[model samples]
Target: MTVTGEDSVIDVDPLEPPLCAPLRRDLGWAQVQRMSQSAGHRDDPVLRQIRATAAVRRGTRMTKVLSAAQVSGHLGGWLPYGFCYRACDIAHLHDPQELALLGTDGAVSAEVAYALRWRAVDPLDYEVPGGPAQPGLATLQAHNRVGAMILGTGFTPSTDDLVPEFVTAGFADLPMPANAQLIAYVPGGEEVILYTYQPEQHGWLRLAGPRWRGLLDTLPGVTPDREYVPCTTPGSAKLVGQIRDREYEAVADPPEEFRVRALTRAARYPVSTLSRRAEQALWRGVPCWVLQRDDAWARLRLVRPDNDALAATGARCYERGVYESWAPVGELADHHIADIPYVL
Candidate 1:
């Protein structure tokens, strides 16, 4: 096959190749040196000479290049391509069973986002948005019939904006039960937004920095060794994982020099606290960090760690699960550091 260049067609042999694989083989030495010269340099003696001879190529800009499948290939296995259902699919999210899928661990989390239908509301009663002609309940039900989708609240249109009056009522009765107090007294008369509201328990919920440690103070219910450990510290270190020698050789290549340093800082007093601390630390990055135990084996699973938090803080801690009992062995020396956990 002939690969077309600016002013030449270089025959590219598919089956055979050369050792010093030419990155710019199609271009002549003058062209290569000219094009590769300091892009905007006018003062350089060599660059000025090269630029004078070379024809400046104006390449066409690409518009629609990579398709969805091609883009997904580049993203690898992190996010499933087809799983991105749009805002209109919000109805499908209504199924109470679907809520279970939002969690990092097998645990379920209670979160909701209502799709907006309209904006006008009755002035007499703040709880009622739109008149009796356009019932709020019917609009919500109509959306519900379309099949639930994960509602994106971050979108421009929100349920509150659609029914400003109703939202005002919602805010007024913040502490009150929606069904009884807020939903009962709409001008047109209606039940409040009837969502299967579950108390947010299980999964990796964002806990306040110091407030999360308060759980440790209340762990008298559990056995002495099973107390909660608060893991909150910051620093960073080059993470080393298991790799075959050949793979390492390939990445390091031609007498590779390793210069990354591991960071150590105070988490809490006892070292066991480092496990949970690392898990919490990783909350800003990766998946959930949960310590799971099965029979004689135990592992820290990288399920749901806050990738955002990790990036925000320089603290070198695992946002996911860290195996407290795991140890370094063979050629993995001087990499691991012990962080003392904070004591109450």
Candidate 2:
């Protein structure tokens, strides 16, 4: 495994909506913090822990993720394109290079995946000139995921839920580690994935082995929006694709600024400032309720009898009259909170 480091860059910051990071019970916060600073404080980088897999506790505010330092070329790091290394946004991190390695997904998806990120082992990071491979890069590469993300239905016009249709359509079942599982995302009305989530996310749905070729050409889940290409990794092993779903994309190619990384989920967590406007459309048809509000960038919690988007996703936040997580107003939207709440 080769390790690489990136140069610090300055651009319009795309604030990854804050995620309530998950920690191992045995792994204390202090230890994780120390490890993150020394290594990649977490996966990807400080502003974008892309490789995170965070899960909210069954009934608690706490979320947990298993993250370690990594620095190898990303394989399928992005969900829709070939691999491209991420230049992290590290304004708060002490080391611009060493990020807090947290989980399988990073900060961007932290907002998209509804606080829970999918954790996968990416065994392709190579050490670059300034970026030396971190301690666990090799172990991560050797870890194989065992699930397949066959094309499925979301809100598309015609929902394709039949798995057997794939074989009949000449797409054979690809091999995956017994532990692997497929994830689905609908990025546009015409395609399932096109514009990636973030920089590292350009490598769409990472896969390994020779069978990857057949799968890329034939996956039924893929919309006509993808542009298939051969792998560009160290050994040139896997086949990847670049998404053509630019019609629905909110940002530009090789973006100069950070735009929406996660478009599916709304910013539900409370913050010091409220930015929910009718235009941001943070929620998919779900309207957010103001539990309480003060000045800008103040704390807002989900009070009782608010909304059902949480229940719809089978998730929640507030419990026993306490707010679990919160963020700043500007981070979630471009406007300010206009409501004056009467709390019970």
Give the number of the best model, judged by lDDT.
2
Per-residue lDDT tens digits for candidate 2, residues 139-205, read 2211121111111110001121100100100001111111112211222211112211222223333
- lDDT tens digits, residues 54-128, model 1? 111111000111122222221121111111111122322343234223211222223221111111111111222
Worst 10 residues of 1 by lDDT: 175-184
What are the Cα lDDT values of the candidates? 0.20, 0.22
Question: Candidate 1, residue 60: CA error in Å?
Answer: 26
- Taking all chains together, each candidate's TM-score versus the true structure is 0.15, 0.19
Position 261, candidate 2: lDDT: 29
